[model samples]
Target: VALADLGRLPVTFATVDPVALIRNAVWANSRRAKAQSVSVEPGQLPSTTVLVKWDGARIEQLFTALIESSLRYTPAGGRIAL
Candidate 1:
């Protein structure tokens, strides 16, 4: 659902920290992950602020979708480190 409007819209990219984006995405889904007995956490990320030219919102959306998808197949008590 998140990428449904991709091509039709102009993607606005800016300097952003992808690790922070992933962290926020994981935080947003923490409740759902807990309800499903799944653990979602951030994986090894740069200690320093790593900025890349990309669409932060889209990156977050992509991570959210990926985590949600993993939640579907990941067994209960399983861990997912993004």
Candidate 2:
């Protein structure tokens, strides 16, 4: 799923700990594929704002989809970020 889609969700909002989410996404993705590696870095935005609002479960699903997609195309030793 695209970040834009997540942003468009009515129940999703800006997270205070975006880095933690990124870390979790990476870790979860790494567990699913042995040939791929995952990493996350802090990103910057113009300002902190709630672009969308969603529950935690939906966010997890979105991340899972993203990781699966990455694993499909990424070569061994390559990295995927969320």
Candidate 3:
């Protein structure tokens, strides 16, 4: 997922390129369904911020959960991102 801290608060938001996010999610999910492969599509990050307000702790927690889940199911040659 794409991450940005636009609000200047301690918080950072999870902001993905909408089109890339959808494509990546679909590709990752499909791979998991078949060969048990996992991969995260590379994010096309913007030079400027996209999302504004978010909780730092929440974002960390979100990534933690995601990584944990991916580790549990993803096999060799699979990929995940922060």
The best candidate in terms of lDDT? 1
Which 10-residue window in model 3 sums to the lowest lDDT? Answer: 16-25
Candidate that would win on TM-score:
1
How would you order the candidates by TM-score, starting with the best? Answer: 1, 2, 3
Error of 1 at 62 (Å): 0.3
In model 2, the worst 10-residue window by lDDT is 37-46
lDDT of 2 by residue, 1-82 (tens): 4755778645545434444455566667666676444333223533554434445556776777777886788777666655
Once fitted onto the true fold, the runs of candidate 2 whose alpha carbons sit more than 4 angstroms away are 1-16, 36-53
| CA lDDT scores, all candidates in order | 0.90, 0.58, 0.51
Residue lDDT tens for model 3, 1-82: 2344455445446554444443444454544434555555434655554543454456445545565577577786677653
Q: Name the better of 1 and 2 by TM-score.
A: 1
What local lDDT does model 1 show for residue 3?
56
Tens digit per residue, CA lDDT, model 1, 40-65? 99988878876899999988989999
Clashing pairs in 3: none
The number of clashing residue pairs in model 1 is: 0
Which candidate would rank higher by TM-score, 1 or 3? 1
